[model samples]
Target: MSLHADALTTLRDWEAPDDEQEALRRRYLTHLERHPDGMLRAGRPDHVTASTLVLDAAGTSVLLTLHAKSGRWFQVGGHTEPEDATLAGAALREALEETGIARADLALDPVPLLLDAHHVPFCGPGENVHHLDVMFVAHAAASAAPSISEESLDLAWWPVDGLPDAELAPFVARALARRRHAGQAGSASGAAGSSSDGGGSSRAAADQPSR
Candidate 1:
């Protein structure tokens, strides 16, 4: 099946964790239906992108990259490549390439954690592009050191509750809140050993001129 079709299926099968997630999922599916090339970067009108929230082993902190273009800390992700077969695979690939996180060491929950529709600049002259982003959560050792990539100015781990001041995207706050909620619930369910599987911080920066 084509990647676009694959994306449709992925979104179709996923049971949204909340009303907001359900709305985003519906928007993504609608976009896909309207644009057959929606999954490709060259899709013109807009495209589907994948991102991941990299959490530490204890899930207390997250790894973020200071995007060279936006100059703000954002999750590691980018346009989907041809090798990507599924949305989750695309997310993992972007995370691995951008963060230098070993695939073997990262444990990704393939389900969608968050969905965001945001504007991205620099597509072409007088042309606006939007990214329907599918976000995921991955866990790695808290001690794992991320090797900075050319796409980022720096890489750092920020406390879930104590994030530094910067041009953070609005979606970042929402994603963080979901992560914290999941962590609290996970902690409460730890005694039972239940396997709990669990964006937007870059919208305005992507729209505005780089500082």
Candidate 2:
């Protein structure tokens, strides 16, 4: 099977309640479900499949990474390592390590959304392909700053609307739409219940104090 077929077929059967709508992206989901303790990447390659989308306060700035190998500006994410026990856990670790941020203040949650697969010109002039991407909702401190790490050519946040027209052409825009939907859902849910963060419903329930 082709790479795309290999990815889509696996995604079609991914069994996770949280990913009902995103089950189609299961091909990109970590191959760790069979092994509860950690991910098994026996056949996985260096291509990144899933990621965490971390946006700033105004919901305008998006934190991006300049990958060590690809040098492409992408989200904080990578292939599932044998150590990753869960998708969300891997997303969080990737964000912290790649973006160089402390994990304490983040209220980031997971929202499994399938990123339409497509190949875009990468780096200088060699690698050109898009690994299937499973994007998740992530958060970073409004005050926390980004420092470019060795993995990136440069680290900077750009106005969500002002991303380079060329680079933001397809996949990036699709990823952004998911974040917008999640934020809107959070707002609507909050008004109906209570204001809180962690996974939304959990935060709302926690807001109710026992009296």
Candidate 3:
């Protein structure tokens, strides 16, 4: 299936974790239904964007980028490209591109972890655009090292409990909760196995631009 169709299917089938999220899900669905080009950056006032928060294999820290345009820390991600087959694929592509973390070192979750809608004043000339962002989570191998991309002013792994941006706390919490839940489920099914080791060490790469 095409990326647009895949996004529609994913959003339609997703079970939102809360009433607010459910509302946003419905809004996203409505936008896609109304605008066939909704997944593209050229879609205008509102478009779907994909992003991924990279966690250490140990789930104790997350990778964040310092956005050049916004001068704010955020997960690695950006606009969807036509080559992307699915929303998750788009997110993974962004993560790899922005973090410089090899695919072998990142284990991305196919399921989206959250959704966010926010205004981007720099997205267009003389107009503000809203990004309907679909967020995913990935776990980096213990030995994984991320290099900075041009899209970021800096790249760093911050402890989950010590995020540079307070606003990201909830998202990190949600991802960790999901991880624990999955682990428990695997254990209950007698399929538990060791996850890739994610070292808790914090490190930052030099500066770069925005999404």
* CA RMSD per model (angstroms): 9.8, 8.2, 8.0
Candidate 3's TM-score reads 0.89
Which window of 10 residues has the lowest lDDT sum in candidate 1?
Answer: 202-211
List the candidate 1 regions with Cα displacement exceeding 4 Å: 165-211
Rank the models by TM-score, top first: 3, 1, 2
The residue-by-residue lDDT of candidate 1 on 56-133, one tens digit each, is 776567888988987777888989888888888889888988999777777666767778778888655336888888
Ranking by lDDT: 3, 1, 2
- Model 3 RMSD in Å is 8.0
Runs off by more than 4 Å, candidate 3: 191-211
State each candidate's clash count.
1, 4, 4
Q: By the lDDT metric, which is better: model 1 or model 2?
A: 1
The best candidate in terms of TM-score: 3
lDDT of 1 at 188: 55
Candidate with top lDDT is 3
The local distance difference test score of each candidate is 0.75, 0.55, 0.88
For residues 10-129, what per-residue lDDT tens digits would candidate 2 score against the true structure? 455443334534553453444333323223222222244557767775566778776667656777776566455555566677777777777764545543544544453442344544
The parts of candidate 2 lying over 4 Å away from their true place are 1-48, 116-130, 165-211
Q: Give the TM-score of candidate 2.
A: 0.61
Ranking 2 against 3 by lDDT, winner: 3
